[model samples]
Each structure stands twice: as C-alpha cells, then as structure tokens.
Target: MALTRQVISTLQDNGTDIMGPDVMAYHYPDASIISGSLLTVEANHFAVLKSRGAVLGVYDTGQYPIQTPDKPLLGGFVTGFFGGNSPWQYEVLYVNRAKLLVRASGVATSAEMAEMVYQVDYYIHVDSKDDALKLTTHMPFSGHYIKADEVASYAAPVVEQAINQVVQVTPMEKINEHIHEVVELLKEHMSAFLSVFGITLNDAKVLILPKDDRMRELISLRAFGLSELDAVRYYTALKMAERGLVSAPNMAVGAPFSIGGATMGTYPVPDGHASVTLPKG
Candidate 1:
C-alpha cells in the first residue's frame, strides 16, 4: 500500500503523528477509506471513485487531460497538481496497511482507543495462530468481549501444542552438554577425595560432596530416606540458597520439612522397623 507525500504532509499538519517511517499514502476507493483514517478531500475523491468506479487522473498541472484508464495505476508520477496545493509536490510512498471498520466512535474513550490500537497491533505483531493464542491467553481481555472459559478452552490447546513442539524438538543441546560437564567435574572431584581419604569411589558409595555444602545437606536429607522427587525439591531449595534466589527464613537444624502436602521431621524410627510407608500416587 502506498501513501502520497501530500497525504503525509496533511496528516502531520493535522497533528496526526506519523507512527512508523514506512507509512505511505495513495488513492484508494471510498470503501477502503471507510475503514481507514480519512481526510475530507480524500473521502470525497474516494466517494467519486466508488460511485463511478473511475476517476480521471489529472496531470500535476490540474488539467483533466486524460481519459479514465481501464487498469488501475499501481505506480505513477504526479507533479504539483492543484487540488489544494502546489502541482509539483507529487512524491509516491508506500504504507503498512490493513482494513478495519470503526467499531465505535464518539470523542474517543480510552476503551475505544485501546480497541483500535489492539486491532492494529494484533494484525501487525501476531505472525501465526500460536502467537495469537499466546497473546490471548496472557491477556484475555484485550479488545473484544470473550468469555473466560471459552477463551481458555480455545487458547490452551494451541499454546500447549506450541510448547510441546518447542520442547520435543530439542534444537539446542547446551543444557545437556552443561549437565555432562557438571557430572564430569563431580566425578573428578570425587576421585581425588577418595584417593585422599583411602576410600573406594564406587558409584553407589560415592559421597557426592555436592558442589557446595547446601547441596551436601540436601543430599544428606535425601540419603536419610527422602523420596527421590522430594530430594529434587530439597535440591532446588539448596540451589536457590546458593544462588540467593529468595529471601525466605533459613531452615532451622532438625526442623521439619513441609511442602505441598508431605512433611518430614526428626521423629524417632522404631528399633526393628523393617518397612517404610510410601506415598500413594
């Protein structure tokens, strides 16, 4: 889509800030202007074009010298033609364009402005259905009236599919590579510790003196019969501590651990207890 320099200058003169550098203006029919921000003169020309399905392309000198051409002129030269200004002022330009009917208007309310901006931004920013879904899921009430349940039902599957596709593809192997590096480092450190302490570094017996003392505490908790999943949770807690990720109170020594539902405390185990109860799935 193209915009004439005349149109750009007029918009600027009328206090309409040129939003993006690429907006170019051109002559379009009345129907097209109905969905666009229109100038009064352009609207009249558009009306004439719509009614007659044709209009004479006057020479830049304001002379109606040529017959209405059969084919639309996609590009052409025009000098300062006298409709409202100098005839030699013709400069052709292209604009980012889309058509949207005015939904509501009256000395613009915030809601109306938001709706207009949303329509334009959605058309420009959303490249695919998944992107649209992400936008809708994250901000469900942007422009139109949509029920919450309906929005969620419609959006969730698309977002889930996009996420699954991203995860399953495994395009970047950096995390896996990093995990391997950490394991190798742990192994080398363990071997050295074993040599110094005169202990065999068997896989099962490896002390796994985690990279830090917090990790050692988590490992100790896990070794004392915490479930593997719970061990991971404790490990995450330890990692957060090591990274200063949170500011929660420190866990007191020998205090009970409480998560979503499970609790671990320093209760005495009966002597001769031969079995442990596991959580029901």
Candidate 2:
C-alpha cells in the first residue's frame, strides 16, 4: 500500500484553490472548461506526497461551487488525475449545487466522455483494495479515493493466516539429543560406505570420494535408512558438491565437488560434518 503520509504531504505542497464556475467565466473568459456544468470543470484537487523515501501524505482540499456571471461564485480545489498519455482526465467539478459532480473531459467523442464519467464514478463509489494497490504502484496522480475500511478488511485475514501457520514448538534437550544422535549415525554410515568405494574421511570430517563413483546410486541407498535430520545434512553436502564447494578428484583445485540433486536438499545433521553415498541394489 502507498503510504498515506506521503500522499497527504504531496497534496499540501501542490494543492490550489480556484474560483467556482460563475466566477471563472468572468475572471478567465478564455478558459475552455466551465466549472458548474459537471461537463468539464474540476471540483477539487489532491496530490500524493513522498517523504524520506516513503509515501507520507495525501492532501485533499474543500469543494467549491461554479456559477455564471450573474450568479455568486463558489471556490474549491479541483480533484483528479491530469497530464498523462490518456485523452481523458478524471476530475470533480465544484459547482453551486449541493451534490458533487464527477466528470471526464479532453475528447469530443461521446463514447470517450462516457468512459471518463464511468471512470470517475468507479473511483468515487467503488471499494476495491486491489484497484487501490494497482493505482498506487502505477499512477503518478494521487487522491483520497480509497477508504480505510477496505484496506483493513482485505488485510486482516491474510495476516491472521500467516500468524496461524507459524510453528511454536519449545526447544528442549531431547530435541538436541536426537539431532546429535542422527548426526553420529549419518557419520558412521558415510564412513563405511566410502570405505567400500576406496574413499576416505579426513580429520576435518570431509568425505573424500572418487569422481567416477556412481554418486547418485550411493545417495539413493543412504537416503533409505536416514532419519529426517540426517537426510537433510546429506542433501546439503550434495548441494555443496554441486556448487563446487566440496573438493573432488576431477574438479580444479579449490573448486567445489560436483554432485547432482536439488540445490537446497539438506541432511539431518548439524553443520561441520560430511557424508558419502553408498551403492544401492
């Protein structure tokens, strides 16, 4: 969502007050648009403002009336999106009448004008959060057309679902002990498996395996007996090998060993240990 604070700030900075329709014809007779007819007048103006890299404000000014030379003139800010590639501009023209008038202008075609009117109506009457989000991200213009209730209603369920999905198990000694046991079991299995293939384990706990070995066959075999935790660790080592983080006979010096499988696969073990896959039937 665009920050409300920035929207308000932008409005305050650029908002303007103009005389209503009655006064505009006399004051600026050359002006092409009239204020009171709801045909081509702007009733109010709003601007979206940004501050400190975040949207901070949306400022709105009071509506005013528009009248002819004989009638009293009313004044208010004009609200709408202006100066874009689109032929139609969205605006509300302030008039002497009590009711607000939303109008679209910029084209002589009736269909185009009708489309603009529809747009204005949609903006003023619709309560769509998705539309609001889209406008905030794409539109350069700004106003307070969005309602607070719409946003709250749309976001509440999503937030609740996220909170509900969070796992909250208590960390305990049993959990740690189980993890250690799985690590040790994996280590033993890997050592024995590597021995059959002439691979060896170093003091650092790295399993040195031949490049030509059937790594995938070995991995599939070991994966069968591994607890969830050990499987995670073994998968992680395999990933490291694929990324060239582990050493192998065929790889360039200091390059990681190459293996095959999902990148994020993990074995059920703590950090700082390695395992090698054994052949399967």
Best candidate per lDDT, number? Answer: 1
Error of 2 at 255 (Å): 22
Residue 172 CA displacement from its true place in model 1, Å: 15
lDDT of each: 0.29, 0.28
lDDT of candidate 1 over 95-200, digit per residue (tens): 1122211111111112112110001010011222233233323343322222223322332333233222322333222223243333344344444432331222
What digit string (tens of lDDT, one per residue) describes model 2 on residues 88-181?
2222212121112222211111211111100111012111223222334432221323222333233234322221222112122122224333
RMSD, every candidate, angstroms:
22.6, 26.3
Question: What ranges in model 1 sit over 4 Å off?
Answer: 1-10, 14-94, 97-162, 168-281
- Compute the lDDT for candidate 1: 0.29
**TM-scores of all models?**
0.21, 0.21
> Once model 1 is optimally superposed onto the true structure by TM-score, how far is the C-alpha of residue 280 displaced, in angstroms?
26
Model 2 scores worst on lDDT over the 10 consecutive residues at 114-123
Worst 10 residues of 1 by lDDT: 114-123
TM-score of candidate 2 relative to the true fold: 0.21
